[model samples]
Target: MAKVDAPAVEERQKGILGWIEKTGNKLPDPVIIFAYLIGILIVVSVITDWMGVSVEHPVRVNEDGSPVVEPARMLFRSELIEHLLVRMPTIFTSFHPLGYVLVVMLGAGVAERAGLFGTAMRAAVRNAPRFLLTPAVALVAMLANLAADAAYVVLIPLAGVIYAAAGRHPIAGITAAFAGVSGGFSANLFPGQLDALLFGITEAAVGSLVTDWVMNIAGNWYFIAVMTIFYLPVIWFVTDGIIEKRLGKWTGGAVAGSSDADDDPDAPLTAGQKKGLAHAGLAVLAVVFLWLFLTVDLVELVSFGAVSVWGGNPPLLNPDPALEVTQQLIPFFTSLVAGFLILFLAAGVAYGMAAGTIKTHRDTVEMMAGGMKDMGYYLVLAFAAAYFVEMFNLSNLGIISAVNGANAIQQSGLPLPIVLGLIVLFAGVLNLFVGSASAKWAFMAPILVPMLMLLGISPEMATAAYRVGDSATNIITPLMVYFPLVLVFARRWVPDFGIGSLTAAMLPYSIWLLITGIIMTIAWVYLGLPLGPGAEVGYTLPGAN
Candidate 1:
């Protein structure tokens, strides 16, 4: 291995890529950024309170039918201190994404630790045709959200090895997988932890206007499923057409810090691992059948009386027939978080047992505990984010700002599609600064959701647009938590790979993904497509008409 000159690499970086790297490096940690924003929010709240700033509420009105006005309340008072000190624990615990992410991680961690996720990803791309390699890796990367953070650790470097085996640039392999994983973060074939996390925040934000709204973890299912489909070609085209051409070709050489025996891309799974995968597959099917049984009507036979019983309208189904079907399935929709937990836990334990990774019940418990340990930083960040969101709500600044912003946007005469597109752009720019999708949405949703609702947009649509922006720019930003890890992965093959190198390699995917995502978002709204099962593109406030 050779040592590369750092200054030379920095000097080589010029133009937009250089600027982004420089600016992104200057930003502080996201937790600290929220703390700073909280300080600024306090100052703004006091100044607005003193100025008597207020906005006419879009939905709420007085007894005489006049619009109700909301004013910014001061946050520097004693009550603020009390809420901060006394209610701190409650605020943190009640934070929407806190429980949802942690619960899903518990099961996902076990699966990853049991080697199920890694084995699945390797199996997916192991024997791909040379031409189909990019899409295979891209597709698996999108689906690899089930593995959580393990996707970054296992699939990415494995992708590089796979590509090199196929005589393609290893860095291009890393780029495609990185784009699909981080850049396609929200795009998935099925609802997973992200859906739970974001929709939980959406429920909290929309609570100001609609108190009874439930967070359906699968609210953005259809949209993100389409996103996975749309992103596949973009990643394939960029990786195969553009990036690979630029990298020229790979020369047979030893990968940095990896022996040939360890880095072999064609290594076959052991007999035990194969059996474990079969067991995991059976566990997945069993869980699915259980959920279906709970949600759908089924018939059962009673041996004693030789009679048949129809198990109709189970607990997950609504008894009333008059309501819309989506309304009837609310219980089923809300159960997806627990569904993911059960599915992963069952599959992990089954795989572990068959593969000899879990010799006893205690091993599963340790894996779950390990999952929570990884979330320590997220818990700390969530504490700050919780305070920021609650404090913004307490000062009345969130609603006031939302109402006024909605009013401005409504009066601007801009088309709804254009506004949604701008949201995609805005979120992309912000992604370069704040990388955590949940953290950024925690602060933005309270304002964006209601503001859009006032303008007749659905919370699901607002969330969808945010997802498009948040994911597209993930690969370009140095601020993304996994950006450094990705650089290290690339450097394992090409030690000269730096922040600029990775960013440059991934920029095409970023640009195309952003462009296509924005277009898709606008088109979905224009076409009036449902964002999910029962989630709509437009919303009307109850009683507003």
Candidate 2:
């Protein structure tokens, strides 16, 4: 009887895992997650509305203008319009934002397609000392995200080759890069498209609870940068200690795709690409210098619907005269553009020097066009994601759930640090199954951000907490879209290493990072340092009380 029950239990476990895998993928997807999560919110909202949760909205009477703040009963299913699903289709479709992201992705795709980015990674690896390989790879991978997809297709694979050549496991190389790039998704010295979109979502959420709420892109910058510092050392230790130790030793020959330290006879980097690197680097440095000079001098980049270099708080950060809070976070807001510009400038110059095609001014323009062509699929994904979010918003379901859930959390006796830790852990566990950062954020942000706001935690603080959880367990989760890719890279050294094998190797890192992160959050709360500009370490009203 015992033996028979054991087999049955095993089968049940397997069944559970299968179900989990299916749900995980659907949950982190923009199209699916937004739909499901938002649907839940709407359903919950209706229930709560039925139970008598109401807010008396204040608005001034106007003859011609629609009142700004109208009474909003938490929407109920019955409250939904008859054309609801019909109306939802257009809203969902509208969510796919293709333009702004593409403007940046096109340039990114060009550099990546031109082999400039490939050359850059190889070049960095070849030049870097062995001891520094872990740190360098981690740092570069985190920074390379500024170029969008460049890190995924380019840096990840290249990492395996570089490590294999350096007498280490190729899989370990991929893991390190993957860890830094995807796991460190929220950690960037410079923000990118993701930042802009998230801030927009946050701004909208804030407005729902406050009048003229401003959520600048840079609202979470300082926290992100600090988190980067928090993450780097942890990653370095994991790569150097566990991964490399497991691989044993590197054989003499280079791996398949490596640029070959001795110079590849097939497709070599040209002097032009080298020159491009020099130029790109210079351009990036110049931009950095200019920014520092301006910021330190208190020059305003955006201010009160105007651009002014010399002024007060609202300089370049706050472009809306009506939204003053944005000014406090301008650097975070504009960094995405800065990130794109830097990647293009660097890759463009590098490509120009290596390919020699960029020697003249015309070649550069063509390179820009070339970049656009490579961005074809990414544009599609972006559009789909946009539609997903927009659809969820129009439903107003996510808002309802967030309000109720946040209200529940606010009423609970949980400590503030406890809340942060739990969110991080939730993100970590969910991350293992789902593996889509933005999708998770989209589903979570509507509820988590507002909920935390009710707890007197700033959205920036909530964003930071979400980031920590989402990134820490990335390596161990088989569900991460990039997880299998890392495994394939790992298999180069340990031929039999499969999903279980990879997870075992990476589990220690994931666990330790989580522990450390929890510790850090507690320390941060105790210190009472601001998470960002005016972002409190404790609870406060979502808006003016």
Candidate 3:
């Protein structure tokens, strides 16, 4: 029997992407990189301060509601030390994703540890019709963002298993799943922690200029929902049509001995697993009904004074007191991450009990604790990230960069489409350096959000563009937190599969996803689409309003 030909060495070094992985892998860890950056920011801040570099506030207002144009001062040693010594604790605690990740993980951790997520994913793909397998895996991968990190851990490897069982290339399944998981990170069917994290940064940036402007958590909801629709076919087609064809067929090797009784496609679902799945379905429905009960104001119930939680507030767009609350999404939006927490927790508890992975309430607590334990490294990363963002803000470098960047774009006299594309491209470039979405947004929003707003772009629109660039390059970048884990997943199937091989496999997906992202961005902006509920394509200065 002939051995399957390994991917060529020349292919690994074929172009810019290969060079990127090689150079990128040689860099220090993301935490160390951020620490070094913090040092550089201090020195640069002092020099820029000495040079007296400053920019007049574009729309900052004074106490009496007049437009305040005070210059933004650069950071100096005294202020830096004060921030480090006094506010360091606040800086780390206030990092937006810290609480979000922890809270959500408490539930997700239980779901994962109880074997609920693993069984659910296995059942999802194991039962998928042969004709629909590609899209099924891709769709599940996209939706798995709700589980955050678990998708990468559970789904990607499972995809490889599913494909190998079906006699398709296992790497193709891995590619498809990774594309959806990371490449399409920003695209989701609904708003969750990401919305809360990104828009909180937007709110902060907007507050820097328009103090009264309200930041809706669902500002990017409509766009992201639509993005999911647009991105699905791209991954489906790229993986099934393009990637699979290039790789020929799977003449199996390391993947041969990788069968499991738990995930075996031939084994029929037991009565208990079936019952657990039914209970899981009911749990999801219960969550849906509960949220609906909280979000909607039914006249029948309200007439009897059994008030809904959101009944007191008016519509987001129109605030006339006499008008009834037509649509209130803030309470719903704010609760989305928590809603996921509840949904997962309830479902996991139900499934765990029925399937015997969790027998008691103590088991559930242990599961949640296990989830928190898994977040140890993330907690450390968060501390470093929070300081980097807060310090950068204190240095005034973010605002200075934004002002100069906005001025440069304004002077370019280019079309808005070209300008927006450039912003996306710039963000893609930045993704190569800083891998954390929240940290990068925290640093960039002070500049990009306000800068684009001054350019007549909405803060939501700026955020949408930033997300496209941020997510598009995630698969190919070695610095992404999960990149090495993904490589390990691949090597299990092909022991000789090095970093270059994994990157080489994923490079096509990255390129096509980015191009599709750029097109989606240009179309959405040029077509003047609303980003989400109450989110517009343009902004008005509060003073002007």
Candidate 4:
């Protein structure tokens, strides 16, 4: 790849892209925006509280069988001040994505600094055809979510490097991967952590109405698998045809923190780098084997004095019959973040040693430190975002708004298919304010699942619809936990890339995805397709058929 001045790449903004970019960039910095949102939330909470605004809690009911009402609470009280002042540290620390990014970067930093990532990218993509790059990244990004939030940190930036190596726009690469990882979040080939979480909530929500309803984590399996198939081309087209054209070209030099010595894509790997890659390869295999070993039943050992039995299904593969299948894999699913940290850390160390990048322990420490240093901006942004999210939850506005929306849909008396489509739209709209998929579902499932069931729409169908809406809007929402992290990634390539820029770039993916997802969902229902194993798109309540 040829390195040129960053400014050599022309900005060709036009049409909707130009308008969105112009309008979005007009906003203040992300931190200030969050602060403003916090103020607005407080005012909304006070007004809603004053007006006695409340909604009937869908799942929780009184002993007399009346729905429990949840009233909005004022956030301007003395208690609010104390919570903010006293719990400031905890609030920042407890932000879930904070630990995820920091831990993963600790390992990823060493990998990049030691030239492991750059070398690997060159070695992997050198012989590959350039045309297939976007689809490959899109596929991997969707599947990579099995590692949970680690994918956001690990894959998105790597996509940029991979694109740069192929002589394509790095920001375009980031856009495609971001869209797949987030906007196509629900569209994985197999069930993973999200399946377990959302389905667990679905099971509970339907339990009151249907006593024997067992949660099938794979309820949306076929639907999501099809989603994967459909989303691949959408991401590919948008990245190759739309985003790349808008991005113009990649005349920029190597990304910061990368080894310029090894930046050329066509350059042959040195003997030392080759040896290092082999070592890193071995390290990755070992990590994979270790994780796999922990997922199966081991030999039973006789207890003798100081010895205990090793025989049993490991925690990673729970043998407990009482839990659902996905529930059983919870331990393993949750362990993926740690698995990735260890994986990257081990590979980087092995590569660094074999490739002559790390001569001393201090070198490795410095690499990790460098990685953390890069995260400085993200840490500040996360602080403001964490407080805003927590305060929104405490104010009861998010849940109340979701419940009221569901109530409105139920009362619309629209056709069942149209109502289902509305559920998708509602979920997508609600996602802007409540970014957590499980959080929004917990509030929604209670109302949607049972309500839809009464209308002869299966809980699986309702869950599937929610998945569509939840995923489609993720890339467009700054409130999404990883949105700032992605913005940080984009700025590494294009310093001018702002919150508005990202939102505008991702707006196309969001719109098309929601449209396609809604269409697929409604069509599946109309055709009476099976959602998954023993999961149908339509339901017949007991004694009604």
Which candidate leads in TM-score?
A: 1
Clashing pairs in 1: none
Best by lDDT: 1
Name model 2 segments beyond 4 Å from true.
1-30, 33-100, 250-253, 256-270, 286-354, 357-400, 532-545
lDDT by residue (254-287, candidate 1, tens digit) is 3546764425677888888889999999999999
Where is model 3 poorest over a 10-residue stretch in terms of lDDT?
313-322
The Cα local distance difference test for each model comes to 0.87, 0.63, 0.77, 0.76
The segments of candidate 1 whose C-alpha lies over 4 angstroms from its true place after superposition are 1-12, 61-67, 253-257, 260-262, 300-312
| Clash count for each candidate, listed in order shown | 0, 27, 0, 0
lDDT of 3: 0.77
Model 4: per-residue Cα lDDT over 1-545, one tens digit each: 22323321234345654554455546566667678888998899999999999877655669998877878889977887789889999988866556666777788778778878656655654455789988887887887665455567667877787788777899998999899989999999976557755765676566535666766656788999999999999999898989899989888854645554443445678999999999999999999888876864433323233432335467577778998776677667556656767887899999999999998999999999988998797688768766776676677676576556556666876767778787899999877766667656755665577767767789889999999999999998766778878877787788777666887899889999999898888888888888876678888766454
Q: What is the model-wide C-alpha lDDT for candidate 1?
A: 0.87
lDDT at position 60, candidate 4? 62
Scanning candidate 2 in windows of ten residues, the lowest lDDT window is 1-10
Tell me which of candidates 1 and 4 scores higher on lDDT: 1
Model 2, 1-545: lDDT tens per residue?
Answer: 00111112222223444465456645544445445655665666556556664432222235665444332244434435434555655543434224445556556655665666666766666556878988888888877766556677677777776676677777777778887887777778766666665655555455444544544455566677777787789889988887778767767455553344433312455666676667667766766666565454433333443644454433335444575553545564455454565556565655555566456666666777776776565445544555445434445444555566766776787778888889899988878676767666756676677666766777767777877888788876667766766666565545555666666666766777787777777677767776655455665553345
Cα RMSDs, all models? 2.7, 7.4, 4.0, 8.0
- Badly placed stretches (over 4 Å) of model 4 are 1-15, 61-67, 129-264, 300-313, 317-319, 413-545
By TM-score rank, best first, the candidates go 1, 3, 2, 4
Task: Indicate the worst ten consecutive residues by lDDT in candidate 4.
Answer: 1-10
Structural similarity to truth (TM-score) of each candidate? 0.95, 0.76, 0.88, 0.64
Stretches of candidate 3 exceeding 4 Å from the true structure: 1-15, 62-67, 72-74, 77-80, 212-215, 251-255, 299-328, 491-495
